[model samples]
Structure formats: C-alpha cells, structure tokens
Target: MTIRMAQESDIPELAQLYQETVLAIAPHYYSDEQTHSWASFAADGVRFREFILSGTTFVATDETGILGFAGIADDGHITSAYVRRDRIHQGIGSTLMQTLLDYAKNHRIERLYAEASEFSLGLFKKYGFHVYDTEIVERQGVEFKRYLVERGVIKKD
Candidate 1:
C-alpha cells in the first residue's frame, strides 16, 4: 500500500470508505441510531468534498482501491480518520495517521488534537495522545460519547 495526499478526485471513494467504516465499526461503541446518523454525513457530497479539500487529507491505497484515509485541519485538529471495514487491524489507519503527523511536523505544527470515538481513542493513545476531555457530541439528533485527545509535537533530532 501507499500513502499520499488526497485530492478532489478521491471524494467519492473517501465518502464510501467513511460510510462503510462508520456503519461497520461504530456499532461496537455507538447505538444503531447514532451510527446511522453519523454515516449519513458521508452522503452529503458537497459538504464532504468541501471538508476533505479544506484540510491536509491523506489516503492509503493500492491496486484494489482506497484502504483508508485521515485528515488534519489547519489548526492541528484531526478532522477525520477512517479505514475501510475489511482492512482494519492491518496498519492502514496507523499508516494514514503517521502520514498526517509527518505532514504536520513538516509544516511546523506544535500539537495535534482530535475528537475520538471510544475505539479510536486507543489508537491515538498508541501515538502518545491523551484524553483531555469527554464530550457528548450530537449529529442528526443522535448523541455520541467521544473523547478529546491531544498529543504534543514530537521533536526529531
């Protein structure tokens, strides 16, 4: 697999991946209503495309197609991170995150933050992120329990 910056052309595939990941994995932590509402965001083509294009988004892909994607905003907040349902546990998400972190470090970002799901919290923790807060986020009338995770910059010699 390869990791690269995402482009406008990747919007459709990214949306599909986001929807699939939310539907398949969110059930482990969220209720059916919450997962459905969250996944529905991916169906908004205009909004989804705009969001992807507005940040430093990266994709992990190969000959088969998109394996995963992650993105960070200008302010050092991770906007999204999703791995295709079938490809989870294969290092796709971690690779995509590392790619984003590398880009952030190159750009002189000092820290990174993300509103992480219960499942994603562990992944962020593996990379040195710690929860600073717990919040109830709502989307389409459904509520989600999420954590605000942050990691400071890791200076390289």
Candidate 2:
C-alpha cells in the first residue's frame, strides 16, 4: 500500500473508511444507539470532505480502494486517523501516521498530537506518541473516551 496526499475525489471513500472504523470499534466503548448516532455524524459528507481537503490529509490505498486515512490540522494536531475495519492490524495506520509525521516535520512543525480512541491507542504508542491526557469526546449524543498523544518533532526516515 501507499500513503499519498488525499484528493477531493477521495473524500467519499476516505469518509467511508473512517465510518467503518468507528462503527467497528464502537461496541467496545458506546451503547448501540450512541454508536449508531456517532457513526451517522461521521458519515456527514460536508464535514468529512472538509476535513479531507484541509491542511494535511493522507490516504493509504491499494488497487482495490482506500484502506485508511489520516488528517492533520493546525500544523500537527491529528484530527482523524482511521483504518477500514477488516483491514486493521495490517500496518496501514502506521504507514499513514508515518506519512503525517513526515509532513509535519517537513512543514517545520515541532510536535504532533492526536486525540485517539481506545481502539487506536496502542498504534499511537507504537509510533512513539506518549499519552498527554485522557478526555471524553462527544458527538451526536455519544461519548468517546480517548488519549491525547503527542510526539515532539519526530519522524522516521
């Protein structure tokens, strides 16, 4: 797979990947109705497309389609990072994250932070992000507990 800068046309697939990831992991952290509502908001075309078209958005793709995506804003704050459900544990998140980190470094950003869900905490940690704090993020009447992970000006070549 390759991690490349996202295009406007890729927004739909990118949003779909994100929604799938959230839905796949929601059972571990939210009630069914909450999960549904949360996922519904995530599928919002306008919002998701805006995110994908923002500061720095990247996608990991193969011949089939998008497998994962990550978006960074305000220099290095990771706004989103999600891999397709069935494609998890296959290093796609790592690849996409590494790409974002590199983008940050190239942009002279001194550090990067990500508000990551429990399902993705380990992946962030694996990539050298340390937990800065924990907070409850709410959307559409659903609450998602996550870690704020920050890595200071780090990127692997």
lDDT of 2 at 52: 76
lDDT of 1 at 70: 89
Compared with the true structure, all predictions reach lDDT values of 0.88, 0.81
Candidate 2 wrong stretches, greater than 4 Å: 155-157
lDDT of 2 at 111: 84
Model 1 scores a C-alpha lDDT of 0.88
Write candidate 2's Cα lDDT for 1-157 as tens digits: 8778889888777767777777888778778877787678656888777777866788888998888888899667898888899988888888888787778877878888888777778888988899989998777766777788999875434
> Which pairs of residues collide in model 2?
none
Q: Please, what are the lDDT tens digits per residue for candidate 1 over residues 1-157?
A: 9888898889998998899899999898888898899999999998999879898888899999999888999889999888999999999888988887887888778889999997788789988899999999778888888999998886654
**RMSD of each candidate relative to the true structure:** 1.1, 2.1
Query: Best-fitting candidate, measured by TM-score?
Result: 1
